[model samples]
Target: MSQGGTSIPDEEWERFLREAEAGSAGAPQEPSARARMVTRRLREQPGPPEGWRTYRPARRRRGKGWYVLGLAAAVALLVVALVPGLLVGWFGGGDGADAPRAAGETQRPDGPPAQEAAGRLPTPDRPFSGSPAAGWADGTAGIHLPAARATGWMSRSEVEQALDRTRDFLAASSLDRAVLRGERPSGAMALIDPHQSDVHEFIEKAFRAPDRENDPLLLFSRFRPSDVRPAGDVVRTRGRISFREGERDAVEVSTDVTYVYPVVRAEAGSEEVVRTVVRREVVLSWNDPAKDRVEPGTFSLVSYKVDATNGGCDNTYTGYFTPVFGAERAATGAGDGAVVDPYDRSTPIGERMREAGDAGGGTATRS
Candidate 1:
């Protein structure tokens, strides 16, 4: 909310509005001097995370000082806008009463204070600042690997190699821009052991012709490019990865990485950034050719589970991620365990595999 450590008062926000309105006639939409100062301060700060470095949402562009005003709105914990309505379609109205709840946010009242107040629009420079993902790592950085140790079946060096490959597979499946924009997840699928043709071909066929039962989302996240685009290039992430010895001289690695994607409707002049979260859980079996008759240096996909929060329930038929926009959906009865908080990183996806991360707890409050 504070831009480069400076706080913005509510009344001062109103003053910007008045000044902008008065200057509207025969005036330019250029940023004010104060906004320019904020821009300089931001440039002095660190750059955004590096994961998929070349992804730009086809036609989106930014104006000067929007990041300053956007961060100001966020830090204030009030609705966004320095010059209210001057930057149209960016955030909820100034007053707390005008705050709009995001379409499929699932945090309970007991959750974080920022989430308690709804409609916190992200700035291009700091997309995760107003959400639970604020504290999460950007892109592949969140997928941390454990120290390699001998685990009966695999040697220490081999275990390390396996871990490295697993991380690559994860990066390809979740953070790859090509995979996200509805392309075949070849980068990820290629890691699958070719001998395990059943699982490999199943994924290939699913992508070729997808449906409810054969969803590629089972292994990767894909959204229709025509419907929505990532708000900023960054994708916030947090979760755990674990490994254990498996049957048939294989090592089983289980990973639970939750991805928070800030997105907006794919239309010109649209700027309200909403988030869609997807939690992907996968079990990878790294088979040893010496004993299992498997291909060398590859893993077989054992199983996978994917759950999406804020991805529209109605959009499931298309087998693409189409998150709800504008308004909330009516409550529903069908769900797993509890309402799965896509933001809750504390929940474990698999049985205790040596305490991968966060303390265990209840999942999100489902509708």
Candidate 2:
């Protein structure tokens, strides 16, 4: 097959080993079955839709200097053939092969290049210098190369302000929004905003059973920011979420956020040193006390508290919610037996929730 005046095989699998080895460093592990099929289809054709591109393996080429050397070698071979005395002298250990002797003289016991042709040395650790997936056109559009690691020190106030801006943004905005926009403000306003009920609905839908319909109404009775403290070059805020019991098929409404900002050193001729904010986020096990109830009628507002912690200090917050659910597992026993006890689940939930914010928590679910 002719592609850009170069011959390409009709079947990729036929030369898969060679191509894969050549591209081992620059591409992701081989795609899975569905992805492979999609790639194969696109490879057989040409352009794809706007958002997608046809799979094209990256090609590596020798440098122009090496090409020139190759041409020179070919010309030298021609000259040597015309002059038989040179080849005979080279085999007979004459000065004509002095360059090869000098090259062999540089060989070492454990050196990588010594094992191969000196001019075609293998890579040390990885093969390619850059990966197509990690290039500018990839998702990291505005990311500048990380500046040199900071020396000197950052002030406590500077760290606080950076932490505050990131915290406020995460608390107020959705993570999807924050990641897309590449910024978040420092405050719990986002977490406390009345407009965030859709977030709970989205969480519920994520866990609902195929046979069961979910109409989750999350009422955040209390949302508060307890404290903020400087830790290294970042500031951590501890908070809580509490609500009344309400109708939820399988709701997972937990929130944890971390923000990282660059520590700028005082410079002579720099306007603003932009610090990249890296957020460490967490989503605790959902607290569902008002689950499948016996009565289809209204239920009292049960409290659900998220004891979120940072480091060793625990910050607790409670809220009230009244959920309504259709009659399905209305039987007095729905959950996995005594594990359904309110106090039992509540105690462990609080303790583990605190641990979740500190050390990542264990997995538990109410089905």
Candidate 3:
């Protein structure tokens, strides 16, 4: 019939009413979506993706015709007596706030509450459910490599090798289950320049009998085997790796990455969970070992620092992280200093590093 100068075909009108009544919706993807960058990137960006408008067809849009059709549909609807179910579906007349919730959903906000209130419980299945790390890439996938370019002193291949070695070092030190569970970080240690005997010896000594002065946790993320264990196999990570030419024809590679470890009490049937954020900043130097006895692909550890937040302030010099949970934090404060956000990656690693339970490991706090 002709209404609002736009004809509403009998078949199209009927189909529209039926679809509205049924409340049609497409099926949701299964297994849930993986988070790309758990940080600000996850938020809705300001505009459409690059070249979005350029690729669109240049066809003219049918503007007010859609509005006229809507008006005609409304007139037709007013004339026809509507059923209760159709009315309810058409205008959302169901329970406003009294509807039963889904099996696992709650009425609270998206993420965990601020530290002022009681800590939130992370779902057992998705340990990162209420955490920012939920959107972050899983494991080493988060550590992406930039296009390898030759520096003044280093060849393209050399720079590429440096990036790989640095990435491997990060994966071995932070994400390895054996190392996290208090085993030796031999893989990570092996990546160090073998010719740097002092550095190698220091790591060996730290592992054998770490004290307040010689702690290995500065470079490796570890948890006390008897105290805490990972909630799942995944460890969310995000960061950047870059390289530049330093003095004396040495290629300097710098890595700044944050690792989020979801851990739970080691006790059987413990449901409580806590996350420990470790931000490590490592500087490695590679020089032409034409005459020296350094390993071909090895890097000399120029310097390394770490910031371990959301952990116990009273870490025993036992060479393992003592993360704080809700119960424990209630009895003993998470820390005395300012509250630290475990997910903040904006700040540099040096500014974040603190002397939290310094194991005689000299003041990591930089001026």
Top-TM-score candidate index:
3
Question: By the TM-score metric, which is better: model 2 or model 3?
Answer: 3
Q: lDDT tens string, model 1, 96-171?
A: 1112222222221234224434555565545564566765555555565667788647788777778767877777
lDDT of 2: 0.19
What's each prediction's TM-score?
0.61, 0.17, 0.62
The sequence of per-residue lDDT tens digits that candidate 3 reaches over residues 202-284 is 57777898764356776777888689876755776666777787645667777777677777888989887666666676777
Candidate 2 — which residues are off by over 4 angstroms? Answer: 1-187, 193-250, 254-260, 266-279, 284-367
**How would the candidate models be sorted by TM-score, starting from the highest?**
3, 1, 2
Q: Give the TM-score comparing model 3 with the true structure, all chains together.
A: 0.62
- Report lDDT (CA) for all predictions: 0.51, 0.19, 0.51
Query: Which portions of model 1 show Cα errors greater than 4 Å?
Result: 1-119, 123-125, 328-340, 349-367
